[model samples]
Target: MGCGPSQARVLSQAPISSNPDEFFPYQGSGPWHTSRADSVMQPRLAKSGPASSEDCPPVTLQELLKKAAEEKGDKLALKVERPCPSLGSDGGAPPAFPDEEWKAWTYREYYDESRQAARGFMKLGFEAFDTLAIWGFNTPEWLLSALAAGFAGGKVGGLYPTDTPETAAFKIVHSGASVVVIEDKAKLERLIPALAQRGEATTRIKAFVAYGFEPEAQQSVEVKGSAKPVLSWSQLMTMGKEAKDSVTESSADPLELRLKAVEPGHCAVLVYTSGTTGEPKAVMLSHDCMVFETRTVLNLARAHMGLCAQAEQERVLSYLPLSHVAGAMVDICFPFVATATTPAWVTIYCARPYDLKVGSLGDRLRIARPTIFLGVPLVWEKVADKLRAIGAANSGLKKKLGNWAKSKGLKNSKARLMGGDGAAPFAYGLANKVILSKVKAKLGLDCVKFGATGAAPIRVDTLQYFGSLGITINEVYGMSESCAACTVSTDQAHLWGSCGFQLPGVEVKAFKVDPADISKKEECPRAPSMDDLGEEYQGELCFRGRSIMMGYLGQPDLGADHVREIERKTAETIDTEGWLHSGDKGMITKHGMVKITGRYKELIIGAGGENIAPVPIEDHIKACCDGVNEVMMIGDKRKYNVALITLKAVGANGETPGTDQLDAGARRINPNVSKISEALRDDVWIQEVTAAVKSANENGKVCPNNAFKIQKFMILPTNFSEEQGFLTPTKKLKRPIVENAFKKQIDMMYSSSETYVRYED
Candidate 1:
């Protein structure tokens, strides 16, 4: 997402609305209100900055859509490659990428569709302030449902497509949603049974709408307790159109009235946290919060890329899970914000659900060729691996030339990070022209002007790998609570490992705290007059900005106990003073960049009473060893820390772990035995990994003290997969789950004194 057309303001203080709730009258016990409403959603101005939330032209998603429709009516807003069942073989999966039919929707058409959907929702018994929970993959229907829910004056939430039937039902029940949108008939069938099993939760549902299916594919799936049949996408649209036409000119349309009643301070979206530690909490984000974040992110684009002013259209690929804040912001909010508030407009291309995987994504990228790209660390790693395999196939002189160019590109990239914009070598231009440009073109990233990586910590090797090929992957840091806009790395300002500087108008500080008692804050950690790389100020990173979430969703009507629990959870993250304490431990550099160290909760305390952050140490090992795909430290109560390592392998579907075949780079090391199961017994493979671990331990950059070094290591038979519940949907390692699953292997490594231990078959 890029900045809009608003001029940069030079105000000393953030613009604050005197009466925040003046626009919307408070309704009693509704989905729009969260626990601690009096304090949670209060308007908080930035301590100091030029950007202000009030500067955003539109206050709500509905308003933003309307503005875009009025101004950019003829501009392409969305594009989708619809799967063709006719071209499928034997009633299996849809047609291949080449045979898929593409469709485009203009800004005006997008708005109209949303408006009609909103009317249909009202016709289906949806009321003002009701919740609409969308459970689907990233598609045109998902976006439309979310917008329509907002347009109909309702709070919108999403359930990850990866969520199980139970998890989906839990979110629907928790949100008190009157309607749920499923991607297709099969998923709808699975969900209806789960909802029916829930005694009270099932009663809340009024309708189940299914999209991405033909009318004939829509089955008579119904909850056991109820007789309501599943509504098809076309049926919903027809209902909406009839409702719209029924409204005479003399009478006010109910949908229009709902839209008019929408307010800036009202809750617009509910973003659920990953819930790694406990049950997921629904984070309440106000319309004001979303608008502010959209503007701030866009402003950064204007500052760095000079976007909005340009005539060229920004092309963005919408592939990430729409349930996540990062995904929703980039794909949904960013485009609308750009269209409404800035001269720049974005055309979004919807990707298939499986497009996040390594092999399948390339086909979609070739079609979309997005100008803006953002991916999680795993996504970036896959792309790097794909490129590596391609390079490994080149022979003789071509290989030599490619390696030479990569060296120059890598050097120039590193220099650029050190503020060496004009320090490129004489041969750098030639390298870009002769090799790097062609590589980017082949990968369909030639059109990408801006690229970023977030969600989890990325490997330095992955960054350098992309840098070597003339692509800079800027790291961004934010969570659901911050509306996914806090700090970002841009071309103008960036650090090697840091998450980059704080966004304009977003204030960030490192507050001092006791490691044993993180809640006991003492004072602000100060970074005095220091050098360029000085990181003297180390503490918990806290953020304060308009983009901060309102509060976690609370069921006030449920009981006093439920309300108290919600308040307790909300208070743990946000303080009375309004600083949202990110559980992450990091520091502010003298240069004002934010560098994350590790999670406070994830810190490992060894038996020797030394506290250590495992992420850096684990990342170091992965960086030193190209074959390793995952690493976990296991010495929370042991004498020394040990690592559980899994080698990269060829996937059956570019996602799930399948064959025992070792990945390309790993196979090169032990060509005699390509399978991981056999490679563990190979002397060459074992020795290489042992040497890599030793190098990682001796690297002071990651392991500052001797205790932090991994004393021993064990190789797992398989990589962590989502199917095994070892990895989250976003591809982050589930530390507790992994530890529990591999307890026996971890125990064996500690019991043995060998430097390299093998997992028992």
Candidate 2:
């Protein structure tokens, strides 16, 4: 209302207004700091078609929140992330799913808490355009503060709580945030070292707030020869109360004020994404873009979460990192919309497994009875491994009854792993009613209505395992730059390896070997531009639409490289087009679904003259391994295949059976591991994975109708991590680290032996 926001430019998802005064937290800063003013308000036709009056008015996220708040002020708007209290220091027992102690905030509570945090930021001398840093594990406080700052139209950046002072400082200074929120003394202490190295580090960060600490807790600190204010979370409420009391009784219209400050074009989120070449790049996302993308996904996931027609009795368990876009949108935005629309109907608990260590997630799931569960590929693989472990232990009993059941037409018997299990892709009736059902019940996942998996490929074997258990794993494809979920599977059209169709309006196309480069001696010989392939051909996947990020915060070159625009016909690259060249390689299926092969950079060249995609293969391998946590395939320009497999430790202390029991299981070849492995090795899951690998080969297609196969492979011991320089913040592998760690095993595995010792974690 105050500023000249171009109505024509606003994004469909941008908020209609953000009344600074009407809202409890208010904008920590003024409108100048918001992404709306820059990215959306000055829109250059972000929508697909030319502007027209007939189009239905856009459903603004901003309007949605305010309306919901009005309709259900007493209803829960959002919940803060809380960690499991039961988890031991050494990552002992996984929290039981239904553990209720982890509830961090109710919707109304989270909204109020964030408002208070916003008020606390104001008391700490924070102003508009000023940024705040949240460094911690996924917890309610971190999320509350972040949203408060966002609503207030300020820049908010989340740093991993586990980050060293150096990494944390780099982001703090880069974002120029004056407020930093944390979880404990350990994270608080990091600032000291960072400030010691550079006094300016503390300059941008005027306050450090720790969550789950008492107001009177003596968490004081000093750096650069001066003391700093350490505010316990409880004290923040007092600050917000004080600040609210002091603001003029008559203030700017909350809705108008919000509309004035919010625009669609500005940077809304500053997420840190680690690149192959260097330090993390801050990926800037606009409010309008993110708000819109989230709405699409939320609507898609809504039905599964039982929010569709049920509208009530819904809950969510927040466990992913807040720094990641997926977690932020869901924990902060999704509930707000759901509340605004349904109000008082849905019940949600946003807590992490780490915070509720008292019980296993199994029990927590039972308590929450969450309708929707989202996770990464590693999680699904782990589930499969756990199932196999229990089945192996029960195979003997199953065998005794196997023939008897066969006589009863129990073709798809859910019995323990048996050769018969491979013949029938269905879950054994008894197995589901007994073994797996018990697992879900124990994990509190029995009532889970939907599941989402992303960040990596999930082998069909893994997917089928969950399907058999009566749990549907919804696979999503996205990246930090794409706000985490670009595409996801619904139970209706779910496929094993495909990432699913383009999200509602998003467009995806493959850019493989350029037609111009097909000549005997092509000019430049550059990587295939978008112009290379036609429909259904494999190539680097390039996409466009509202989901694209604004750019890297401080890295121009990298941002330019990622956001290339081009005309649809020529495949000519244009920096101005806003099309994102996703580094992921893929092919458009004739049916129009996208089949993501692997990362463009991670594609391995097989000695058999095939381009192999390791992700899918790795996905299956992890599925078959009892304790596999992560698997990295490495065989570029090498014969056959070899992998660096990090087995998931069975228990907190990496418990293994006694030698006698272990020998028994090992000697019997574990009917369970063998059956699962056989399914992976020949059940078409590994076949599909290896085929993807071969297709990625420079050799291109494997002569129509022929899918590539893994001639041979070796699975080795050891998992990679950031601490070990094996993974980036996004969880993608650092190939160099993995290759170096497994060079010897890889060499031997590819040798005539075609086998190696697989270690037990």
Candidate 3:
């Protein structure tokens, strides 16, 4: 019932379908004929269609880790770079082997360490189903802590390092976590005070474990009025070693007994939603949910990127926060799953922060040169902007050559989008040999065969812009509720501006809703056929699959009525039929690819009675306007759409400055043109953004009714960020929070007598 090697015998017995007519009926037609616009209409399903449960049995994380260690004992599992204080003096000599700072760990070593950590948790009295909350950036220790918790038969909840004290405390308290693992002293400082404030509510928390403590700095943090013991990483490990040695063969191993008690249906992790529309909720993902997602991703990689070969070496860079589902899948699960299947896969954990001033990501990428890369849209956008800025700074001839190569690459990319083999034109191949290849090598993407962008809607222009530079970033769509397993663009069948096809064993459909309906309880009619899909078939995207979450965690003791309400709402979301109602609005194309439009609750109903999705309008504005870092269309229930724009800080030369330079400028406290807020006051920058918005409206890329033909826009003094509670951890705008925070600004846009910026200037 397993896949790949485990199902080799079954697959060999099955007859392979080789009929050209069955695979590609219109082979004689040109590539453009295969586009979604003209392709045959079919139900939205996986490339191989729906798979039975028996075909892919669910496996637990502990089992997966154990199998990987047993199979790939000697293979490289992790690579982490640590500062070697012994090698060099901070004030004096440079260290030898500066480039060889990485500490390597094999699968066997990782397994042994994780097992020891599990025993340590047992010693700390962590029982089955007990919550173990981890807060940290991407590090080997973070991964080990998560796996160790799983091994100890406890569910793990991740807390983002950027979370404020109050927010972290809420998650920890809500998840009922008894053990909290902090990354370092900086995180501990923020969390300890919050935990102390909780008083009796946090009494269940038995211990606090902190890692990465500096040995030279002999400092101890005392939690005021709290008698709970706080243990260091080394102390916990020592306790585990002692405890393991004391155990006899006659006595049952506590860790082993707990592992045997684990079930596929048991909650493995509790991932909090981004809370874009409302307050965050804990999504309970079962062991089967994670296993299904991991297996589907691995299968997709093999089918799309040819990553299944035993000899092929796959490298992944873990940089994103493990608290997020996308980060957890890419940085933790993907590598572990791949290692279990093949020994050639390697994961590089990125601990160093990238300096925006010098653009260190490019430098790191050059070193890792990962074969598979996944990043949020912001990461990709920043890289794109950096590359464009570097190109603009180049001398006349070099800039011209680079621009020429980019144009050729764009042409090749467009052809590939239309289903043609991505072989570049003769001139393009020559240009790539002369310029593009070197550019890719310098950016450390020369070996990258697969690149993906998700977490938020990215501008099609941004995708094409990267493609023009020889990096085709495939857009993916998913949320934490689905265990980050949903639709994805593949090499075999993909379309520009689409999230691609559904994964195997997954079912997706659009539920058509009337725009005029404002009631929360309104149920839309199911569009079952192509004839029923009206203009703009976009509606609330719903799916049923093995990967959907069990349900949101409910507080049963709140009240009978409240508990009943929670159960009713949960039933409405997941339904009796097993379909999870995704709050996202999307449509399935004729080719079975899904195109996400916007969030259902975030849609704006204009005063003119036209329905508008803000994402397309915002994306269009950002693509047209270089000065704008973020644009939120805020005209809900208004006559026309007006935007709240946040401009990037400009330098002396009027160009957008890097974040580092801006931070330094702010620290100087000089009454000069250093701050982003000060830069926004410039008339020239205002006019630039105004003109960009006008151009975007005139171009009309989005639907006519939902166009960016806004009446007015107000420039905000500061950018929306997670620290300010205006943005989620994943960088998505918290619509309700932002709207409430800027209520005055929004009212002013409508009530003010100022003339709207026009296209005629």
Candidate 4:
């Protein structure tokens, strides 16, 4: 796990800032500097191994919550908001001003509520290690129920709200969850049909818990043929209270007994991967894995930002779907751990409570002003697009001033990359004080010191553009199996287009693969030594560490057989040696930074035997056109690569609207416009797309043999979406699904008599 000699050399040559605080391992005494064992937190396990005391802390969610309640009982732990009907309601309609109320819970109250829910589970005959499925948004109740399951020594699995009834039922049945906590009556109603469809397969589920509605409201809701009873949140709590009251002080509390029995290696959570190629596999993460990831992330953040006493002042916005590992870690695990160990941190849930304008993240940012912001590339892309559009719409002096400010910002960013502090230039002070400040305020990024992007590869130009604005976005790399813990770019050492160094306690290596071996599945080479590292060493990225998951549920021996089965279905694997073969073709730089090139399974092999990585081509095309949203390169065993492009639908104001808004508007314009391909017949959109592709082909970097120059392309009528099953929940393109869905369109491009419509360099 130690850094290689080359890595050491690279680190030694990195620039040292005059202000040491601005550099790595910021020279400041912080909470993390204190002995972790003495932080008044202890592992929940009764016994620890020799190395466990010093390295792996046997911590669990139950322990983290209990410690937080003990340390900061009266402090605000959560703020749940809900929209309410008006007092003088017109048939229970929403208020004129849209009335809303906030429900604040102290740490002790939250803990007590969790215990009550745990007691309720016990009354319903639930036992330790049982699975409880949670299906909802990032609500306070969702957190409470998840914690309750943990308190009862049960594992919790979350389902994406966007998942169809069939998909949700499949997970519920597959995970063997006996209880399901749903968002509301509507969500419960949606599940019933799927349950009936599933028949006996869903018989394992004994009960359904509903929230976001009154007890009377839940009583009216019914499942046609389900033997299980549906209960309201309050009813569950009431049941828990009654159960707790009946227990004598002489008897050990059921919740306490469950907590005591908890072990670090026990599966605490099941995060199902967004099964793009096939059925989703439930990734079983240990309590220790989650705790380790939290601590490691905290340590890195503190070192990079010099955050000593400011840990308490940090705030994070929880808006991403909690089903994803990134969302669960950020919104649940990080805050819980921080609250236990630091002076108190706040987590703000940004769902229905604030009457947040759908697709208007700008408004949410302004209000939250979170110190730490995490987003997928798509979110950042939209922000950049909006800023660019606003600047383009400006006229005369305003436009000139805006351009000057941007130029100065870009200059400052470049200066920082060359080892200077990212300070605004003297000539740019007026712009920073006026235009930039206003813009930051509007975007609610004024307080942001650490920004991160992950789940998908973002365009390098997009990252550079944000850096020019003085917001350095660290591109993080991880997967569901790692508990979303892997490489992360930091303020201390970051390179453009790289996913930075491996996380502490984590080890990564790249292996060489023969380009001609199409049948050979991507695997960890026998000799994965760093001595073999070179330009030609680029292959599959493999990682192993404490933060890695125990294994996928139901798959005990993750041997070659298991790996081969997974590859057969999804073209991904985790070898028996414990290294996760990421299937992602990548290379580790001398500096230890990892750069992902493309997916091995998704790589295009042309008829001429050229192996082309599609990602670079797609990114280049995207950089060249504002009108294009996504590009799927198609040329597997074909003469040359062609692309299926999805156009960005523009609003009446001449700016491309958000996907949701655009889809709605398109439906109104013409119902058939549901797919982006249908709208590709537009002459203007066609011209813009063709020009973008041509420009990419001319300017894009490519290997001698692996030329990514697109000979032809057809614009698609529809954009890929999670709802359409063409994308993962995290917004990554599902290659197999996309190809299958657009097979006819792909076939048309190859069969049509379109000649070499290529642009000359």
Candidate 5:
């Protein structure tokens, strides 16, 4: 719990401001530095449409921070809460974090410390515009380093904590990072040797800063064979503080000069995408891109939920992977903008990744009481499943009361979906007070005004399940290239399955293309209505705006070949007219709502050469089959489609399997079998699963034609997991890898004449 010297602490009696102008008064023309030619490409916009609104003018990270310091100086900016080590027993038990006190940092202290860290970078021979690669989980140090790099006129990239040593080294070398910030000594120990092995590739890394060390601890750690030592976080700050008075050949320290010389259009963040095929691509997002998105989100939130800066501020939990753009946007960029632009200063609570698993999340949520929350589909599914289990255990009057309350909640939410306030029913009010409110409080979601789901496909049933519990999980659609969001579902404009309307300033369209011959394409007309869309209008979703990234990272300095390679890759994504093709099949309504269907690459073609989207079909099967974890459709070039299903099982992390022991839901599917290994052989389990598949195929809503139905199916012994390289870091399935991994089982399913084949082990 003792991290180091406290950077800042929350004051018991900080003055509150009601006026926005008094809270943040700075407004100035910003081309602070000249645009550098270092970028391989710059952000491009369409021929017509507003790139940004006049209300939210473009600003650099430096400008934004400076303004915050000037106006919201004493406001709390960040807080880290962890259980006291002294209070927990040393019996290998988890820490009790519920009532733990948080260490806080005000805007003034945060900005000042980041500047010191920036000066520290200059002391370590860090040059302008160099990339700073961070390999760690969410923490104050991780955020500080990112801001420090931006202050030093450089861009920063994050490496997933779960990334392998080779993958981490590759990203470090590929980005040409001058410095790397690792979470702790343990990760540093693992990464150093791998970097050392790279030899010339890693020579660009002039220094390594180790975070999570005590303030008075050793300044540097020496590795066995390496000549250079890794500097501790405290040591980096000390260097920055000392460098404040030390003038070089120049008139002032390089920190101030870099700040003055950095342009808003320059790349500020590097998000490495985990592509299914090859090496991860480093997405270059500019300062303007991030700022534009932050401002736009604020506007949307204010319009929908009346989100504003006031005496009562918004609290957010930063638990998602910092490597992902959505996490960074909400946890990092959003807070800064909220503090600077409005009177309600935001407070960010940092949580470790482990806190996201099952029961641990509730502990953090109960403490943070965040106003806004975002989760992937898997996270929501687990939450709903957990609640379902708890509800099933209810007895006597509790069971009857719970059932009655849930029905009321579902009716209320469904009413809202049809343009009603959902508050007209007297029973609805009583239900919320008696049951739904208590349920929300227990989950630490009582204060959550906005809940969202994104990153991967989510089931409609899961969304509806949350609605039954009085939580509306708004769906959002975008990629890392679009700075996290292109379309967002809000309270004002929401449809259960839709991704919602396009952002105010952005332009979006669905272009028509044949699944077999995608190269030949044309722009499809928008549907006359939001609900009714013809098949002809369903096409590849595309968008363009100022929020779009500058370009993918390139190695132009290497030569013409590298330059050409960069151009080729860029052209594949962003067309000449600046529309960034999303690679997703979707349709846009005349009302501007967007509904994403599936990925073009994941489209399955049958023996009759009929185009079929597998995701919706897979989703339907999972929804129909209780205790089913994952349903993958396979029939790319066959007579009919088949499925590979994974049952819920006991796991270290709830989703990823650690043992074959069946979970409660899975066991309930067949009480005769207690383990997945046994359940696979049970005739009852197989019969039930077969019936579910039959139900899904016959449901006209999902599968309109016989060609789209899943014909044959087999249950996989294991789940598709990231640890097994069958899933991406975001929990998205690597379709080709999954198909290749189960080739034998898939072939066996098709070879058999039976409708449902049981693989003989």
Candidate 6:
């Protein structure tokens, strides 16, 4: 998703409005509304300098650092993006939303804190060869741990906060970390029993540092260990403060201690990627590689989607786990990179801030009137739910009428459904003005220039709803193995259903398709490759660039299995030599853009001779019905498809859709979630989705048994979760785990139609 075309202005300071654009500082410098018909994308951010490539010598990240050091020694590096951390219960939940007045650190302050944390770890006996394990949700402290560890010349292992106790302890022991940073005492308590079971491994942790602690924490951390606990977040920064104090009027830079400690090519981060078999393997990324990849992200065409500092307003609401590459890149690397050297040039207003939380995390996103926002698909889905709920709360008829009008391309209009239009849907802007707009006002996301949806494909309808609200949906595409920078749909050429062009500095080409399997890759269903016709070409996507990772850590066997030099062929084509084999299968479009279809390993092999990719079914089915939150098609080796569905709750969005004479204005099950859920379970649409998934797979070879498409499925009361071991950290369900966990429910689905059935939008 990218920004759609820019539209004309309609200004109003008040949050409530007929025109959605008015909430934007339309009266301010930027235009408010954008044209619906415009090409999809947010307004492009103003150039940071001349084009980043404008410099003749060309500015690599290393070169930019060199320039920043020489010209702006005393300037900021990284700082707290908020005024101060909100210390509260449930891991700082209530105050996670946006605030206009808050403390944000300057680059100098951030650098100082990181250096101090590095020194503090050092003081506690951590050294270059030692490892410090950090397990926590995303927060300033999480960022500090990674940065400080890197600066101190030590490698860090980021264990997910929600990891099973066994898994947590295993990763800790595996990384050989001598120190551990805990977010709070509750997590520490959970770790103690598991650690105790590991004997020598858990005892090796010499010190524990707690982040986001409440006053009731002291008694909870008493485990049977000699290791001391520390709760000096405020006191720990004295080193930086003291260093600042020691500086004289004519003193050299006070952050010299922090600067000289960093070294590239050292072990920077250890991120774990689960394998097709056995346990998860650690991917070791070098400092040089990590920094360069982050820079590649900075160079992406979609960077303009963020809130610009120039808007006199800017903010980032962060909730992604800092342990993962995406979180670390955004919170620790991207923010530092963006704000560092050009502090004077960027004037981002501080508003939205994310506080640490377990289970679910959300915040008010205060953005520059024209700003960039990046989030995974789940975030947008939630936003859509909120909008529908709000709009439906008012007169259902009026809301329907309003939505219908808005659908007809009217921005804001008044419609009274005192009688007629009762059967129609709400006006288009109806949801925008009445429902989503209020949510945006509360979250302060009304001014967002554009936002990115990635880590998974987002339903186009979700993007469309946000578009109606005046926020552009910018789609992003990438994989963790590729340093998380890959094909992001740029403002131009952002075609629906395809990831945009290959990014600059990266060259993508399809080399070969197993001619025996050429029919599988054919566009017209098993047609031959030709000129005005086709030339069958497709396979595992191969990528070569600085952004590629340094390979799996300590797992040379795995590295040998996949990593290779770039491929270079007979026709000066590719160096067809050795290219890193990305596990995904894809085809090159006529425009030279790479279109990935599915994972080679995850393809379902059916007993009745149907090949399927569950994702496409999940995507299409979930889209066909508003009731289903997530759909996972199981039955990989079985005779047919079976699904495990998580319902989108009734009254979760827009007054449960319809209200009949039964006084069902806001009833939960009438047009209830279950009823709606059953409607989507309609056999016709199910068959259609099954066929679509099949078509996307082996290129449209329908199996003989239509009834076997999806004989039966269990509707789940709750969605899968990482902590529950039903899903991976990235939100992809763990197939085996999910099947085992829901075995009883699955049995019921097949043995009987116990799950309710009905139909409603």
Query: Over 4 Å off in model 1, which ranges?
Result: 1-50, 84-101, 215-224, 514-520, 523-536, 556-558, 652-655
Provide the overall lDDT of each model, using Cα atoms, as 2-decimal numbers: 0.76, 0.53, 0.67, 0.66, 0.75, 0.49
Candidate with best TM-score: 1
Better of 2 and 6 by TM-score: 2
Better of 3 and 5 by TM-score: 5
TM, every model = 0.91, 0.73, 0.84, 0.83, 0.90, 0.70
- In candidate 1, what are the lDDT values of residues 1-761, reduced to their tens digit? 33222222222222223343322222242222245422335444433343433454337888888999999989888888765233235323343355135788999999999999998888877887778899988888899999999888888889988888888887888787888888867777788778776666466678878887653544455554565556888999999999988999899879878988888877888888875667788888888788878787777767665556575578888888889998888898888888887777888888777655435666667677777789899888878876787788899999999999999989877776734553677799899999998888778787776788998889878888998887878888988999995888776665668787776666677887655544567544545322222334667888866677888888654568887899777777776556678888787755566778778778898777766888878887777677777888988877898998888888723246546888857766767878889878788888888887888789886777788899999888888877676777777778898888888888898899798998894
Q: Candidate 3 local accuracy as lDDT?
A: 0.67
**How much does each candidate deviate from the true structure in C-alpha RMSD?**
5.1, 10.7, 9.2, 8.7, 7.4, 12.5
| Candidate that would win on lDDT | 1
lDDT of 5 by residue, 1-761 (tens): 10111111111211122233321111242111112225533333322223423455667887888788889889788888643232225322255455346888888988999999988987887788888899988888888888998899898889988788888987888787888888766777778777776666566677788886542344444333444547888888999999986866757766878988787778888898977778888888888888877887777676566565334567788888888998879888888788888766778888755565434767777778888888888788878878887888789999999999988888877766624553535588789888998998888788776788889989988888888888888788899988999888766656788887777566677987545543446888877665564678788998766787777777533456765676567667766456678899889776667888778889998788877888888888788776888889999988889999888876625334546887746767877788878877788888888888998899786687888899899887877777788877788889999899889999999898887777665
Candidate 4 TM-score versus the reference: 0.83
Q: Model 1: clashing residue pairs?
A: 2-298, 3-298, 5-342
What does candidate 4's lDDT look like per residue over 1-761, in tens digits?
01001101113212222232221221232111111100121222212221133544667878988888898777666764455332233222232221124566778988899989988876776677778898877788888888888888888889987788888987887676778888766777778888777656666677888877654534543333555667888899999999889889899777788888887767778899985677888777777778877777776666565332343545667777788999888888887687777664555545443222235445445555777789888788867877776776689999998888777777765555423454557776676677776677678787776688998889998988886666778788989887895888667667678777777666666765445442343443322322333346577887755667665665312345644454443223444344566777787654456778778888898787766888877888788776667888888887777787765553211112234223322333344344454455544445666777777777635433435688788765446676676778777888888788778777777777773222111
lDDT of 6 by residue, 541-626 (tens): 65544344444444212233322211111111112232345556566554444555566667677786554656655666565554
Count backbone clashes in candidate 6.
Answer: 61
Q: Deviation in angstroms for 376 in model 1?
A: 0.2
lDDT of 3 by residue, 1-761 (tens): 00111111111111222232222122231211110111121211222322334444557877887888888777777876675232224223222223356787788888888889888977887777778888876677788888888888888889876778878887787677778888777777788788777665676577777776632223344444555567888877887888789889899888888888787667778788877765567777777778777777777666556654455457777777788898778777777777776535555546353222233455556667777788787778777766766775688888888889999988877766634565566698788788888888877787776688888888888888887876777777888888885887755555578786676676666765434431232334433332333445667787756677777766432335644564555666664445567888777655566777778788888777666787877787787765567888877777778888875542211112234123321222233445565555555556666776776667544646443367788877666777677777777877788888887777777787653431110
The superposed Cα distance between candidate 3 and the true structure at residue 524, in angstroms, equals: 9.6
TM-score leaderboard ranking: 1, 5, 3, 4, 2, 6
